[model samples]
Target: MDRVKLITIPKIEDTRGNLAVIEKESIPFEIKRVYYLYDVPTGAYRGAHAHKEQSEFLIALSGSFEVVLDDGIETRRIMLNKPNIGLFIPTMMWRELDNFSSGSVCLVLASDTFDESDYIREYDKFKLFKST
Candidate 1:
């Protein structure tokens, strides 16, 4: 729902270890910022907001987690458990991260810099904005 997709990044395998690579050409948008979430307590949640124009790609670097996506019309849950897999999130959708396993590291690649004005933090307000 809401055009969310699971993307596979290029992975290089070797005897030493495995490597995953991500570039602007491999993703749908140019990455402008990068951040991560880690050390979250069990049963806790994060990212309960929606962006007006920003988009993001989320990757599970160390452990597993679930992403809850809502578009004001439908909802879907996506699991991120591998370093080479990413979840691409488009604009105008609400996202929440939860069900994180211990030692989970959530890496996010964003298409824009941090802009407070672009965020819609309330669910009812987001629905109204989506209708208009």
Candidate 2:
């Protein structure tokens, strides 16, 4: 399976800069939840897990970061810095986030509610589970 998918957010350019918008019906799925991660200390990492059924879109609202994604057989890396673009993560893909710039903000939009049971946190376990 492919690891990460990039969705081109529709951006309306302006004299000031640019603006991007995300609507529930416009995406592949409805937006059921929203969250963000920020204030990450230097040399630290986040999001070492995979979701079973939830799909998500991640945007770099500020600064920059790297999103590393892995399926059972393949892996991919994406650099997110622009607020107008988003990385779409499908279900059952393992992901790890790192290389965060100072004051970086990672915003995530989910298709499901907060459910710990939908997450696979261990890489080995995820690989094994995907095989079955």
Could you say which candidate leads in lDDT? 1
Instruction: List, residue by residue over 13-128, the lDDT tens digit for candidate 2.
Output: 99998888787654677888999999999999999999999998999999999998888787888899988789989999889999999999999999999999999999899989
Please give the distance, in angstroms, between residue 56's alpha carbon in candidate 1 and its true position after superposition: 0.3
Q: In candidate 2, which residue ranges exceed 4 Å CA deviation?
A: 1-3
Tens-place lDDT per residue, model 1, 1-132, is 647889999999999999899976778999999999999999999999999999999999989999999999999988999999999999999999999999999999999999999999999999999999
Compared with the true structure, the alpha-carbon lDDT of candidate 1 equals 0.94
Kindly provide the TM-score of model 2 when superposed on the true structure, using C-alpha atoms. 0.94
Which pairs clash (backbone N, Cα, C closer than 3 Å) in model 1?
none
> Candidates' lDDT values, in order?
0.94, 0.89
Q: How far is candidate 1 from the true structure (C-alpha RMSD, Å)?
A: 0.8
Best by TM-score: 1
Report clash pairs, candidate 2. Answer: none
